[model samples]
Every structure is written in structure tokens, then in C-alpha cells.
Target: MDAATAWLVAAVSLLAAVVGPFAAGHALLTKREPQVATAWIAVCLIFPAGGALLYYLFGINRVYTRARKLVAEERLPPSLAPHPTSSSHGIGPEYAEQIRISDAVTGRPLEPGNRIQVLSNGEEAYPVMLEAIEGARETVMLSTYIFETNTSGRQFIDALSAAHRRGVDVRVLIDGVGEYYTWPRPSTLLRRAGVPVARFLPPRLIPPQLSINLRNHRKILVVDGQRAFTGGMNLGDSHLLQSQRSHRVADVHFLFDGPLAQQMEAVFAEDWAFTTGDERTPPKRATPHDSGALCRTITDGPNEDLDRLVMTLIGALSAAREEIWLVTPYFLPMRPLITSLEAAALRGVEVKILLPERNNLPFVHWATRHILGELLHWGVHLYYQPPPFAHTKLFVVDRRYAQVGSANMDPRSLRLNFELNAEIYNRPIAEQLALDCELIRARSRQLSSAELGERHPAERLRDALCWLASPYL
Candidate 1:
């Protein structure tokens, strides 16, 4: 062989040796999970060049770094800072422990005097929300994951445009990836209508920040800083069950008025600032109501706030004495959550989880089946609500405490995507949500160990494979 060809081969070998160990060392020092680190290390060493490329493309988490930097540099507007401690007036002695746990999990105080109304679907929620937007005299802020430019989406665009024309301070934030659901994107229409709109983490070639994960899955709408609407419902016609017909998605949204609205607005302000780097002064705080419930906002994401929601959930579960009711579309919970569920059931706390019979994502549904037998073995009750695919997410404990928001039980919602939830202390609202869970349960079929075992061998294998990939799903 020529000396030139021999030199090229030696240079390539030296480069691979350097790259493989460098990538493997980064993974070993940074990865939180031992299994994940070992797998990446093995891959990097086994294939050398190809493994290094793959690790560069997918193994490193840029989302966490960017998010942490942004959070560290920018702080929430001063007007929205939490009080010294949670309010103890309306809270009872029984819930003192839960309050303390939440206080530590999230450094926010329990805002009292919040009036909450559970709206069943978009059909019930949209009209009132639009009415509030129409009457807005000061500011209007909205952030949603999906903003389809369909019939329902057009109405919102029109309303927001009109509000902007009236000299109201209006801002709209739509998820970067979720804006592509339809042609002539909602961002395009909003901008054309002279509304100030921004997309959160849009991927492009110029600057090149491309990630399919790390989505902003939060849904929030605050009108005039006096009332807000939030929950699992997205802004699209699909949520309007009666009108959507074949493509209907059943979900629940909450209409809230009082100090909680300001807390919701605070969260919006934080996101808006993060997206645009413009932290305007927040609007005036709403007058505290005479009588209402205590509420606190819990924000979770892949950065500084990682694992907060799950920790808060575990805290609530540990504090439960009587019953726990949970409903969500996805069910790929992390190991810690699984252990918590088992412990809750073993403690004789009536633990019930409601999930959709047919999920929009079939892989998640199949993966969920693989863990059913374990939960059933531990006395946890599971139910599958009949179709149209319920998109509601809620957690009610002891008929006196509840958590409502856009976060689901899956890894995507818990650890990757940005999420928002509210811890509520009110018997009436919690009892109402528990009643709704009961209604869904009545119409649903109980999932038993026998049913899970009846699956064919091939089906079981498919589910096992899916379960193995649950962390990514």
C-alpha cells in the first residue's frame, strides 16, 4: 500500500479512538440513569464513528441546558412573587401535612379565595372564555400547545385581533412544534390580524434548534388578569365533541376567578418572558373573593423544575387517608411513581385510575397494558373509559384536595414537556371532580388481571417491546 493511504488509515483510527471515549465519558458523567449511561457507553465503544454520531444527535439533552440558563437569567415579575408562607385560614388540621409538603415541593404559597368551575368540554368552555375576551379592558394573555387554524381556532384569532384593535395589551404564545397542525398556521393568522404572537422553540435551519421532544404542553388563558381558563383542553374544534362528530375529543377545562388567576398570569408572564425576553409589568391583582378555595400553582419542566410535579404527586399520595382518584390520557409513569401507586394501594387507600379505552397514541396504550398485572396484583383499581378518547387530566385526594392542569402521567408530560398544575384545597370542588370521576368510572369497564392475561402471545410480546421503550414514548 502507498504511504499516503497508510497515513489516512492511521489518522482515521486515531480520530475514532478519541471521539468514542470522549462521548462515552460525557454520558457516564452526565446521564442520570445508570442504564442509559451504560447503554450509550457501550454503543459509543462498539461502533466508534457511527455510535459517536448517533450519540451527538440524540443522547445529549440541549433542552435542559437551555432551560436552566433561561431560568437562571430571568426571574418572574416582582408583582407576582409568592408570600412568605401558605395561608392557613381556610385549611383544616387534617391537610396541614399536605400543605407543608406542597409548600416545600413548590416555593409558592397557597393562594386563597379562588372560585373554580369545572367545565365539561370545549363546548361549555369556549363560549364563556370568548365572552371574557370580548369584555377584556386591560390585558389578554394566552398560551397553548396546539393552535389549529380551524373553525374554532379562527374564532379565537378574531376575538384576539379585535381585542388588540381596541388598544388592549394582548399577547399569544403557541408551541413551536404544535403550530404546524394546519395550513396557514395560527401564528400566521394572528400576526396578519395585527396581534402580537410568538412561537416557543421553533426548529429551523438558520439557527438550528431542532428537537421533537421538550415541547411546551401547557394550556393557559388569562383575561384582563382577573379570570383564567386552563386544563387538558387544547384550542381546536376537536374538543367540541358535538360538532367534531367523528374526530371528537372529550376533555375538561376549569374557569377560575380570584387570586388564582394572578398566579396563572404569573406563569404566563414567565413563559412570555422566556419566549420573547420582554418582561412587561404584570396587571393589577384581582380582588380576593369573600369566600373561595386555597390554590397554588406548580410549574414543571425539563430544566430547573424537573421532577417537581412527580414529587408533589408523591407527597399528595403519601398524605392521602381515604381515597385517591386520577384520570389521564397517557399512563407511562416512571418507576418512582409506580412504587408510590403500589404503596398507596397497599396502605388500603382506595386508589383508582381512569384511562381511555382507545388512546390516540396506540403505542402508549399497548405499553400501558404491560404494567396492568403488577398494579392489579397490588390492589390498585384501573378502568378504561369508553371512547372518543377522554383528554382530561385530574387528581383528587380525600375529596378535599385536588390537582388540575395540562400535565399527563406519561414521561413526556412529567419530565420532558413544560407543564402547569394547580393544587386546590376545597371540599366542594374536589368532591365535584371526584363525582365526575365516578361518572366516568360507571360508564367504563373495570380492567382485571384475567383480561390482561387473556391477550395472545404475540400481543404480549408487542406490549413488552413497547413497555421497554416507554421512557421515550
Candidate 2:
């Protein structure tokens, strides 16, 4: 071979050798499922450098998104929201209310008459949560994916420790995957302090056998078996909001004091059961009374079709009569939901999606942009909230139905991971969620097709790549 050709060949060969395995390693680190890892293997073996770049920019990122199998026993029907067989999409108040009660004692609803309060962020959520812990009259249950051992996490631990000290039943559950890194793990700290702490699905070390994507993404806290709190918020030190995230985050949490709160209490019980092999403290049997809210507790795990959360949201979108407003930090909905949002706008449902201008996951940013123009064209209003990456997952429909939880709009939150969301049929909760969404919209910049089209070449290329990774983002 000529000298120049030989050098070129050698350099490219060297590049492929180094890049290919590195890409595979990156995928392994991100918890890419075995199938995706295998796909990466094919891509790397075939295209070499290009495959490695594609996988790095996308594929092997966040293994938690892989199609991890949920313990089959946990998955409920996709229609947990109630059968929409009737021409009317709205669930009957009686039916929805019954779902809340039955979720705990039985898989049915009870009359709800509890108060619901929206807590803005950790600054607001933590204190109230601690107070609840302090005042725990009976059992105290807490579950979360990320439980930091930082300033805020310590306070909750102390409160729970105190509750434990007070001889109240206190059970704390933390995702084994999310809190895997600690001196002995934060749960250990709680356990040593005489509080019972359980880890959910601790990672088992298996080399080259990738795929443990089924993660518990729900963040739920219940005290006294009567009051509960849930939302996208995790117990971490990233207290308030910041416009620019130099590694920052923001979230929303809600407190409930009705029969609806009992549902969250039950979700915690189920997880505590799944992990610790123990059941929740039996409820103080009282004649179930109404707390005055129409609600349902719907959960989705593996062993069922993927994207149950998004599918549930699609149900709302399909039934949307007036306006559909959604906010999620990472917005990679599966095809059906993507189509549903577009169709909703096309069919005259006023649809709006609020996302972060720059989320922690930029590849997700690209994925969301790919269809932004399509949505905008279909009369869907796309708005980008200025940063700190508000991690609130909320949906509002016609001032009637609302959903809030830790699940993002992406497939990972829907299909691959365990997610908890409360479906509220009351007008007040719906109105409140809608108003908050509007407040967030005020801080956001609306995007149009013209601006997206005007983006620089490099920026556009990145977005296209992001869209390609949308399925797993």
C-alpha cells in the first residue's frame, strides 16, 4: 500500500479498536438493556467508528431505561383508570372514588373526603414531611428512587429516627439502584438508628449480562396511614429553583388528608412488601368515610405492556375536551402518545407541552425537538420553561382530570420503570395543576417552527440524533 493510504488505514483501524469497546462500556455503564447492548455490539462491529459515535451520543445511555422485567405480580391492567368503552371519556365520580379506597384494602374505591395541598418544592415539601414524621400517630412509610444523605435527607432520617424512638411503626424504603452509593447506604444509617430501612431491587453484579432497567421511580411518603405526599420530588438537598442548573433540579409535591391519601400509603406498603417481604401495618379499621375528592391510584410496572403511565395520559388526551397541558423534564413519549398529542391538537383539543429549555438530558432535548414542529403545526403550543429542569410531571384536562407523579413523559418512566401517579377527577385539583402550569409557562419561552428551522447546522444535527434515541430516552 502507498504510505498515505497505509497510515490512513492504520489510524482508522486504531480508532475503531479503541472506540468500539469504549462505546460498549458506556452502554454498560448507563444500564442499557442486554438487547440494546447487543444492538450496540452489532453497530460497533459493523460501522466501527460511526456506530461507536451513535451509541455514545445515544444508545447505551441510562441502562435504567432498558426493558427490565417487573415482577409480574406487580403490573396491573393498562385500563386501571377505568374502561373508556362509553362514548364519554370521563370516569364516573363513584367509580373513580372507589378505585382509591380499593387500591389499599381492596382493588376498589372508597368515599373520599380529605383535603389536598400542593407543596411547591423541597423547601416546602421537606418541612411538612418532617412535621408529619414527627407527628406520626401510627405507621410512617416513605419510598423514593433518590434519597440523598445530604442535608435534607438527614433531617428526614432524624425525624423517622425520632418516630422510631417514639415507638411508632416507621418503615423507610429506598431504591437500591438510586441510593447504591453511601458510606453504608442511607438506609443503613436509618437501620442502625433503630428504624427499619429496606432496599428495593439491589443491583446484582453480573458482568456482560446487562439489563436491570426495572427501577422504582415513584416518590411517595405516607404518615399515620391517613395522610400522604407524592410527586416528582425526591428527598435531596437541591432545595429550591435556579434558572441555570450548575447541576440543579426543581420539583413539586402534594399532600393529601382524605381517603385518597390512603392510596399512596398503600403503594408504599406494596413496595415495602415487595422488598422486605412484609406487609404494611394493618389499617385501623374504621367505617371508610368520604374525604370529598374523586381520585384513583393507578400504577404500572413490567409484566404488562410498556409505557403504562404515558398510555394513561393518552387516555386523558383522547378524552380531552377543552385544554391539555403537560409538563415533564424529560419528554420522550412513545409513538402512541406522540401521535395522541398531535391528534388532540389536530382535533381541536387545545394542547400545550411545557419542557425545560435545557434539561439534564440533552439527547432527550433533541428527541423532543424532532416532533416539535409537527406538534406546533397541528396547533399544539410548545413552550420551553427556562432552566433548573423542573422535575414536575403533571397533566390537566378540561378542569376535570389531573395526574401527578415521578414519571416523566419518556418511555423509561412509562414502560421500563415502576411509576406511581394519582388520577384526580376533582375540579379543584385539576384547576390548581392548570394554574401552576400557567405560572410555569410565564417563565418559559414559546417555540415556533420558524425558530426551530432557523437553528444553526450543528444544533440541528444534535436534535436529529436526539430524536433517533427517542424510543429509549
Candidate 3:
């Protein structure tokens, strides 16, 4: 061979030797699923350079390292310190295990004396939130997955700007991907008004971090560090009942008071600190109440605490006795959750799930359809809510316990993105949520086993293809 040809061959061989084993070894060590590891190894062996770059940018979990460092450097105020024991929170002994597991996962104790108000839709939630922002005496913190620049978004912008002008400490955090929903991002408006704002994991090309998959999906709003609002509602005109928009969505949100609100503030503070590198003092504790509802805040993400929401759901489902009523926009749960739901059904516990008939994301809807046969065969009832899509996420167990938050039933909410939910041991709230589920079910069409099995062959093939992409969807 010529010298030039020989030199080229040697370079290619060196590149292969270096990239192939490195990517394979990294995948084997880091990837928990064997299929994922095998896929990475094959890509690395066949297309060495591109595969190595893809693995570096997307496969590796870089957030853990940064999150761990920040967590270690963070100092909690005396008010936010962990309590000695979370056992005596007035939660029944039957729920002792669920409470303990949640505390272990979130590192936040179950707090009592919490007063929760269920806001039926954006009309109810937005007014209360704006009022709280206007009356802020100390600080206002807001975080959301989507902050569209529409009529409702402008209202929030004005309220926040007015609060900032009044010398209230106003800070806002919007997801990097969610800010592109409109021509001018809402963060720009907030910044123009001199409100402190930061985008979580904004898109970048230099470092090549494909952070688009990892989003901050939590919808949280805290005012004066004592009261907070959160759930699935985002800042968009579609959420308004009077919006003339073609597509509108209905959702539920909660306004919280007492110590549970403090926990919500802590989640926002840590996220803000991580994004801006700004140290934050723990929020002051709200005045304790002698008697009220019991609640706990559960935060989960791909950072240090991973798959926490999934684990918590599985645990709750396994322990459910009478019935499970779940409502979500998306419905693509992991294998373990599916198994737990099946088990619950086998034991004669009613398992009913409510999902939007026409989801905003067509691919996700198709994927969810592919799994319905299995669940239906196992005696789990599936109901589809007819149109003007519903974005609410809620779960009620035995009409006595309930969980509501921004997390959906899909893998994105379970294992990929950052999510927060409130677990309530209050019978009144659970009953109200159950009634809401009943209302949704009243408008929903339940699919029978035979109906699910009657899907056309071509449609089934399409659904199967979409189901294959569920892990990343």
C-alpha cells in the first residue's frame, strides 16, 4: 500500500479503537436497561464518531454531578431542617409505609396544619394567584414548564411587573424549551419589566448538551414564602374559558397554605440556585396551625432523585384497597406501574383511568392506545374524555387519599423531567377530587376489551411503532 493510504488506515483504526470501547463501556456502566446499553454499543461500533458524540450529549447524565455539588454546598435554614420524625403527622397507620417511603425519597417530612383549596380551572386559579402576587409582602417565586406570551401570560407579566415595581422580590423561572411557544418569549417581557428571570437548561450549541429532553415541568407559584399554587395549569390563553382560541384546555390547580407551602418554596429555591448560582436562604416557616389537613410535597427528577414519582405511584397503587381513580393528559406508565395497576385490579380494587380522547401530541396518543388492550384485559377500566383537551393530573385512592401535581402518567413525567406533587391525607380534598373524577368520567367513553381489540391492522401497526418510542416520548 502507498504511505498515504497506510497513514489513513492507521488513523481510522486508532479512532475506532478509542471510541468503540469507550462508548460501550460507558453505556454498560451507566445504562440500567440492557436494551439501551446494547443499542449504544451497536451505534458506537458501527458509526464510531457520531455515536460517541450522541452518547456524550444525550446518554450520559451530567445533571447528577452538578446537582450533587450544589446540594452539598447548599445550607438549609433552621426552619427547613429535617424533622426528627415524620411518623406522628396524624396520617393513619394504614398509610404509614407510604408516608415513610415518600419522606425517604423527598427528604421532606409530612407536615400537618395545611389548608388546601382545589381550584377547578384557570379562571379560579389565576385570579387567586394574581391577588397573592399583588399582596406579596416579601417574595414571589414562579416556575412553570410553559410560559406562552398570550392574553393570560400578559396578565401574569403585568402582575409580576407591578409587584416588582412595588419593591417586592419577584423572580420567575421558565423551562428552556417551553419559552419558544410564541414569537417573543414571556421571559423577555418579565426582563423588560425588570423582574429577575432565568431559563432552566436553555438550548446551547457550543457544549452540545441535548437538554431539550430534560425539562422543568413543575408548575409552581409561591408568594411571600407562606402560600403557594401549583398543579398542571400553565400560563396560556387556552386555559381561559373566554378565550376565542381554537384549542382550549381545562385543568386543575391548588392553592396551599401552612408548612407544605414552604416545602414547595424549597423546590423552587434549589432549582433557582442551580440555574443562577445564587445562594438562597430557606423561606421562613409559616405559622403552625393546631388542626388541619396533612400533606407532603414530593419532588422528582433525573437529577440525584430519579424515578421518585414512579416509585411513589407504584407504592401507593400497591397499597390501595378500595379504588384507584387516576386522571392525566398522557398515559404511558412504566412496566412496574402497569404491573401494580394490574395487581390492584386482580385483587378486586377498582382501577379506572381517565385520559383525553384527542391529546395535543398525536404520537403520544397513538402510543397510549397500543397499551390499552393489555390493561383492559387485566380488568382495568380506561375512559377517554371527549375533546377540548384536558391537562389535569390527579390520582385518588380509596376516596381518602389523593395526589395532584404537574406530573403525568408518561415516562417523561416519571423518569425524565423534574416534577412536583402534593400527597394529601385529607378526606375532604380526596372526596372533592373523586367528585371531579366522576364529573370527568361522566363525559368520557369507556373502552371495552372487545372495542380495543377491534382496531384496524394498519392502525395497530402505527400504534406499535409509536409505542416503541414511548421511552423517549
Candidate 4:
């Protein structure tokens, strides 16, 4: 072919690549959040190849949707969800009512009276979780987005393996991609040891092309249908050691007893039923503890027909009486969230946000700065958690309610990824969470207009370019 003919052929092929999915993406009848739809359109327009790549990477596929339809077609028995006993503590009336609505919507009650404990980092959470697994009697259910079969992951494997051998009804779930070469097949090892493990939304067995975007991003652990844990902590060596690895992630996890733990178990049951089809009639077990805290679990995913994280933040911020505090590894907020944060500060609601000084994704870190400048101007106090990549995501409101989990304040998470979080409304737990925020504050400094202006022109341009591509990040 001549040079002119070759150029025309190349142009035609590129057009087909963009137009095909762009048309299918809109035409498909799958449920999507309004913000996600808007962002998807923006992503397609800005960079065609990049958008196509993202659409393939995290985009929804028809197979899973069809599988869901097939499952819905079957007549399944009622999976028993007996409520757990409550502890001796309940939150104030205002917070309690929100719990009621969440309970109704989620079909899981907040055990009003429960003892809550905060595990500062992996060093604390790891041992506690292992102990919980060690004590499991009826069931030991665990799910994580990233489960490296590395050295650290192996310890968890050993623990779970021991639990399985002890006649504990053990079930483990890991994301197919998150455990990709960096880790080995945890499920395979468990299978060899006669334990049951399933990959949530595993890659399609038939067609390799369909394995692109589907992932189970939830990180949760519930033991014996009683005690439970959830947060950013994944099973890995980096979470334990300051590591020789490229980027060490700092994360937080929670240990729950009382009604909230039951709520977490319910969340696990849903994923378990979806993955294994082992809808065994589980027992009604809720151990009431002495800690006074009101807690509920909230699960979000592409399957959920709403933006749970963004809505929860906006609702909490709008209803704030005195203060609001937040922390996340990624700081890119969509338009509605940005506006909500700005309005909360403008109304004299003490608003503070903590993000990592050095995020694992540097491109995203740079992109988050431009629009974030607008927040600082609106009196939204911004603090950067110093060193070691703070991966914790937290939200506290009015000294009463707080949420902690794996979801970050970024488009990729708020819109695309599946995540799990717990909303707590007990004074002592709230205070403890607030104290954790302050420790991050002690290490982080406030950003000023002066510092933003002092950036080198080259740095500014780099940030600006990345900001334009924020939808994909």
C-alpha cells in the first residue's frame, strides 16, 4: 500500500476502536451512577486510546451481568440472616435514626450497643485478626482485594489453613487480578490443604478478552459469624515492614463485636452466596460485648445502583453541627463532592482532610493539587499525612459518626471499584478515630496559597496535564 493509503487505513482502524466501545458503552442497559456516566463520557473524549484502555481495564462486561440475570431467574431459598444481640451502648438520637435508614436500605441492623476497638495499623490489626481466626468455631470468612501470596500473605494462609484443619467452616476470597503475578494462587494452596477458597469475579474461563475490568475490591474478615474486621489493610509484607519494595502502603483496619460485626457478616454472606452458591442455613449468633458503640456496615460496588461513598460524605457534611474530618490516600473528588466540601467549610463547619504527602500513584497525587487549591481557599483545612504512604480512608462528622474502610477519595474508587466500610456512631469510638486523625495532622502540615504559587512552572504544567486526565485515574 502507498503511504497515503496506509495513513488512511490507520485512521480508519483507530476510529473503529474508539467508536465501537463508545457506542456500546452508552447503549448497554447496565446500571451506572449519574456521575460515573458523566465521567465516562469525559474520559472517552479527552484521549481516545487511553479511554479505550480504561474501558477495557475497568469497564463493565455483559457476561457477569448476564450471569446475574441467570441467577435471578433461579428460585433460591431464603438465606437465613438472624440478627445478632446488641451490646449495652447506643448513639445519640440523631445518629441512631440515620442508622435506622441505613439498616432498612441495607437489610442489616446496627447493633446499637457494642464495644468498638481501633487497631492503629497492620502491626496491631494483624495479630488481632489472626487471633480471631485462631478462635473461630463455626465459620471463618475472609475477603481481600489484594492478597499477595508473598511472605506476609503466607502467614495468613497458614493461619487460615490451621483454622480449616480445626474443623472451622473456612471460606476465603481474593481478587483475580490483585493476586496476579505479585502473588501466587492462595486458593490453590488452600485447596491442596483441603480448604475451600474462591476468587470473587474471577476471570472468565472461556474467553480471555472478557477478564478485563471485573474485580472484587472489598477487603473484609468475619470470624465464626461473630467477630469481624475491615479496612485498607491487605495481606502483604509491605504492610508489615517499611520494606525494600518500591512503595510501602500505610493502612488501618477495624475489629468489631456486637451488632456491627453481624452486619459485616451479612455483607460477607452476600458475596459468598454470589461466588460459591453455598447458601447454607447459617446460625443466629451475635455476641454482645461491653464496649458502648453503635456501628453498621455499608457495602458499595458497580452492582450497587448508587454512589454510596460520595452520598454518605455529602449527607454527613451537610448535617454537620460542629466539625467534619476525613483522610484518604487519593484526594481527587468529583464535582459534587468538591462543592459539598466547600459549602461545609463556608458554613463554618470545621472541615479537615488528610491525604498522603507521597501517594503511591504520583501522577494522581500531582493531579489532585490544582482543584484542591480551590478547597483551601474555601476554608477547607487540608493536611498531608507525612511519609510512608498513608492509605487510610476515614470520615468523621459532628463528633458522633465516622466511617473507615478501603475506599479512597478518588474517581477510580468512588465510581468504579467495589469497596466496604463501617459507619460508627459511638462517642468513645468517634473520639478514638478523631485522635487518629490528629496524629496524622501532627505529622502533616497545612497547604497555603503561598506554597501553591511557589511551585516551579514545569511542575505546574505537569500537574495541569494530569488533572485533565483525572477521570481515568
What lDDT score belongs to each candidate, Candidate 1 first?
0.87, 0.72, 0.85, 0.73
List the candidates' TM-scores in order. 0.93, 0.78, 0.93, 0.84
lDDT of 2 by residue, 329-435 (tens): 88777667879988888888889899989877767887778778777887889898886767778888877778887778877777667788877767878888899
For candidate 2, report its TM-score: 0.78
Residue 401's lDDT in candidate 4: 87
Quick one: ranking by lDDT, best first?
Answer: 1, 3, 4, 2
Model 1: how far residue 124 lies from native, Å: 0.5
Better of 3 and 4 by lDDT: 3
Candidate 2 versus truth, CA RMSD in Å, comes to: 7.4
Task: Tell how far residue 173 is off in model 1, in angstroms.
Answer: 0.7
Cα RMSD, each candidate: 3.0, 7.4, 3.1, 5.1
Better of 3 and 4 by TM-score: 3
Candidate 1 lDDT at 102 equals: 72
Candidate 2 vs 4: which has more lDDT: 4
Tens-digit lDDT track of model 1 for 1-473: 89999999999999999999998998898788898899889999998888987777667666557765456244432222324556447467878777777776676677778888889888899998899999999999999999978888889999999999999999999999998877789999999989999999887767776665778998999988889888998898999988846878999999889888887888887788878998867667787788998888888887654487998899889988889999999998888888888899999999999999999999999999999899999999999999898999999999999999999999889877889998899999999999999999999999999999999999999999999878778
User: Model 1: residues >4 Å from true position, as ranges?
Assistant: 1-19, 47-50, 72-84
Candidate 2, residue 397: CA error in Å? 0.3
Worst 10 residues of 4 by lDDT: 70-79
Writing each residue's lDDT as its tens digit, candidate 4 over 104-195 gives: 34444566656666776667888899889888887888988877778777888899999999899888887776767463577787788888
